[model samples]
Target: MAKKLFMFEKPLGMRDTLPFLYELKKQVRSVMAEEIERWGYEFIETPTLEYYETVGAASAIADHRLFKLLDQQGHTLVLRPDMTAPIARVAASRLYEDGNPLRLAYNANVFRAQQREGGRPAEFEQIGVELIGDGTVAADAEVISLMVALLKRVGLDRFSVAVGHIGYVNALFLEILGNEERASVLRRFLYEKNYVGYREHVKSWPLSSIDQKRLLDLLSLRGGTDVIEQAKTLVTSEEGRRAADELAALMAALWTYGVAEAVKLDMALVSHMSYYTGILFDVYAEQVGFPIGNGGRYDDLLAKFSRPAPATGFGLRVDRLVEAIGETDVRGDIECIVFSQERLAEAVELAEAKRAEGKRVVLQHIAGIRDIDAYSQRYRSIVYLLGRGGQ
Candidate 1:
């Protein structure tokens, strides 16, 4: 027989958000949504389940991690792993028109089946915006600036955005390694941030000292705008040069937006999202070990849905953002009226009046509570109406 499960046990990677935490998340979402709306982005939502053949293939998340199931008619379906792909599907099919860029926003829960991990969540909410159909350096700058703006609006002061160009990395790799297979090995090292392993692997290759040194130099490409100039020297191909130019242009545009101060150039930066065709970035908060948010240009994704457009966007992990913002004593402002039966009418009237005045009032019958003192402590203010008129 199978072992019985405990009542409080949740599925692997699942979590419960109690009232206080839920309120915090709600507040964060509210401010973020308002800020996004103020930037002229209209919020849209897509269905939770999508066909495995479509969005699932385009999502770039590992196939093993997708939460897949068969529909009643035997069609394969999956819970969306991220908002970007589904938004791409929607924009391509219905919303997007050629030459008119669409600014769309989403706030929803995405799912990815996790291995038996202790702290990773299988389901979490993402707040993000996608600017579809615009494919300029200015567009890239806008999304990054907006991301910085949203974080600031939500009271996050200590965060940095590291921006990079995949095109540059690819050009440099192809120019050096000469084939995708060799390039793939080094790319994995960079993705895992294993600089030591990257150096060892590059050294192990039967290349000249200069080539190996060039590969090793990719790690030091992190810093401010001058790093972009340093990056230009490492690549000889037109593609590589163009990528450097794009980063320079993006930096200029960001400076125009007054967000260049928060951004740094990382020529070696890469993402697991393989569809990122050009610039990409990750946002880090002071105390968070992982990125609180990330986004980049995915010019090829919308074409997978047959609506070719240049799109860029960012998604903030609500859980991580909340964690970065730290905690507060979220004792809500609530008033409670404890009434005896004789004073029930007065209590109801008071509650209604206070509620009409935008106050949170609870009308409690005194005898119903087992521990009145403990229960009363939950509210900010308490009123006792016992033993008749005006008491």
Candidate 2:
């Protein structure tokens, strides 16, 4: 029988990032954490594994996408697909009992079994903030403004935070003489950005001609602040009008936050987070094909765990961020290398002295090397003669 070969491979949707890229991610995290702290968000963390019954109790998407497994005691557990639900659980249970209106920050990894639409990655490093107990349009604006500031800190100048309201589509869905379940079928198509399916479904489904036209127009309508005024004319529901008003107010506030230039009003932004009761957003940057960050308001989720309170937040994709803004490489200065074994101890002492003085030193041993010049070039280090006659 032929001998079999051994091969190594990383699991699909995961890979080891090289050192330069790894360091670059660290730099990005440092900048983001500094900004998060400056904004008064106290850092917090959640377990990677949680009871399936905890996070899955609210939304179908969350229930299905979790990386599920049985724990040691045979309890259903899962690798969290997103932090929002887990944070909500914590807020309703622990934070709510202790304090109110938490401005919490966290750095975490979210694992999802399925890939997202438009080639979104499966595993991601998520850095985020949540303002629990504050539900006003101001709270919503603060999240978006901070997103702008964070992107600028990371050297990403060309980007836009697309402000949206889930109520925009939900309002229309209610008006079309269909139950939410029926309307959800259409909403799913929109979330997938499946324009053909959306249009065909709308055409065959029972809807007033005027409502159909307005919904289509709403789908296509995305622009600067003026688009809010356009939405006021097109959407009829009180909820829809209030959503537009709230969006306009939030944009005005973003101006005060000095990030209005980065704000874009996209009325069609239907979020995957089902519990979002109000403003929702997606951050896009130039040279990157997909969203680098996402956030919104979800008031209903916390109620499922312990208490009901208004909350809004966002998460930035560290992997996608470095992909958009390429990683940085750190170069070292001229390193001092000592080759002779006899000189090794002296070289180490000298290297320590230099290191104490804040210089980079490389100590190496070479026994047979005759041409020191070749070794210097090969190691890219300066050889300091200490133990030989040159000493």
Candidate 3:
């Protein structure tokens, strides 16, 4: 039997990023990782494929979104949809058993089987860090502060990290909806900002007028610093109150760390991922309709791997971050342009010398024809080969 050959083109939702754009994306990741490392996080890597049971542990990532496959033994595997879950597997298994907080960072590509909508790339680049073992609210504050500092350093003119605690949201939803599945559906409607869907879903539910109003209010609970105080009044459950207190404490820590202004207490900021057990946040910049960065405290994720540890991390979408920064604003002039026809060797020597001195040079070789003057327009100086029109 002959093996079948496949005709191919680059798949949809995947793209070849060109030179300048690619460099800009790299710069963004480098700056972010530098900032992350300075804050004590070490870099780590995880496999692209993992067992089905492991990847499926996180409730936030949908099954349909995963790029699934079967291995040689017929066991299921998947291209990781998110880095956190894989990181959790490693941390729990034996990578960080020192009992100290493990601070790790990664520059990774994640694959999603979901269709590309709104120009969303199916192959996404993520630059992120996970702070595991420390469950304190201060850890959350530090992570949030790092996010603000990172965005500012990356030259975002206007952006804010909208922060929320999932505990409060879970409690509030469970308080009204009374079941996880129903509450999840409502959470999606709110996350999508689809008020019509939310209303339609709520109409048939067994709840009072005041509770319905409260649910709508939850969706609208977003704004400046003052909104935190307002969230206090809406708390009906002890869990909600605890979440509010945690948020307040985080804000206080952020204020002390000089990043309070970069944050907005957005109670409406619930994430679709059920794994996010505590702080949840998204970064919104001007001109981009989607989040350029997001992550939250997932205290429950590691426990699924049999390592019960609290972890807080965040990931910045490298492509989105590059888009937010706009075009690369590089300024320079080529030091020399070597124009040569017969004297290719001379042109090469001149180019090499200039490049060694840390100057940009362009070498143009022709077949004893073509104007050197035409090339002079693009560079600062022109060098002639074999003394032809010697400058």
Candidate 4:
């Protein structure tokens, strides 16, 4: 027998946004868009579905998480898991010039299948910018500084950004573990922030006590500018030292941008996005348990598109950001006009006038509303044009 459908059932990890929440999101989006434009970034959009072999593979999202399908010609396609890879495709194909850096922004919904969780969204919106063609510490500093400016512009007063260099972390791991296979095992623990598991794994390994101590000391490299100095001592490789130097330079640039007070240095910070080759960072707010947004340097991604250039950017989850900002009521501005048949024309005229004056107006017939009193309470003000003379 066919299964019957429930009235209110929605797919797992999908959500509905009601009118109040919609208005709040609209306001937040508007404010952030203006701020991004002020910083010289032009907004662009890409298709929702891209060839699976191209964007889907390069997206850095796991294959199992991608929502894949077949097109009419039997070619595999995917609902974009993230905006960065798709943007890279476009930038490489059409936008990037020989030397000039491109600043592009996007606000769009991306999809990824949810396997183990019910509350996590399978489809969500992301607002982000990608800075392509630049490979300097200054480029890194600009993106981080801009992200901080956007959060502050939207009234986020208390939040922290944890900054780290992927290159440094990888170099340190290889110096100690001696192979990609062994290094990735410990790297997974850092990505998951399971320090206890990491410590136990290190202790169980056959490495010397001194090497184990060095690995354990990596966890403690989280704090202010002094953490950079501590990081330099732990890594003997030139690659590791250079990564530390880049972090130091980034911090100095951030100080000049005046956002250094909001950032912290975490030497062990890592991201699951393997494309990220250099610095990476995550932003967390006071109440949100998960990161509201993240971004990093992906100097290798554009090469997959046949245009090898440096790129870095960040994407903020709109839903998580709304949660971090707290609940707000944005439904009070609308005004309603209730009218009888005799006053229909008058009600129309009044609503149009109010709307022209930049007010939100809703016109309704008296007979249409079953409970006039309850309906009237929904708006900030109600106009009565019930009788022929207008009450």
Query: Which regions in candidate 3 have their CA more than 4 angstroms from the true location?
Result: 1-8, 56-59, 116-118, 176-185, 197-213, 331-349, 359-382, 386-391
Tens digits of per-residue lDDT for model 1, 115-232: 8757788999999999999999988999999999999999999999999998998899999999998888888888888888999999989998988888889899989889988888
Q: Please list the C-alpha lDDT of all candidates, in the order they appear.
A: 0.91, 0.80, 0.80, 0.92
Give the per-residue lDDT digits (tens) of candidate 4, residues 313-367.
Answer: 9999888888889987777599989889998888899999999999999989888
Poorest stretch of ten by lDDT in candidate 4: 1-10
Candidate 2, residues 24-100, lDDT tens digits: the string is 88889999999999999988888988888878555334566667899889999888887888888888878866546
Cand. 2 TM to true fold: 0.87
Candidates in order, TM-scores: namely 0.96, 0.87, 0.85, 0.96
lDDT of 3 by residue, 1-391 (tens): 2343324446667777776577688778888888888998889888888888776546357888877889999988988888888888888997769767988888899887757564878889998888999999988988888888888888897888889888888888898778999888887876787878988878777789888887877767776656777777777889988888898899889999998887888786766656688888988888788889898898888888888999998988888888888876543456654454656667788789989988888676554436656756656676666546455
| TM-score preference between candidates 2 and 4, better one | 4
Q: What would the C-alpha RMSD of candidate 3 be, to one decimal place? A: 4.0
Any runs in candidate 1 off by more than 4 Å, and if so which?
1-4
Measured with C-alpha atoms, the lDDT of residue 64 in candidate 3 is 85
Q: Which ten residues in a row have the lowest lDDT in candidate 1?
A: 1-10
Residue 256 of model 2, lDDT score: 94
- State the weakest 10-residue window (summed lDDT) of model 2: 1-10
Candidate 1, residue 309: CA error in Å? 1.1
In candidate 4, position 149 carries an lDDT of 96
Please estimate how well model 1 matches the true structure, expressed as its whole-model Cα lDDT. Answer: 0.91
> Model 3 Cα displacement at 236 (Å)?
3.9
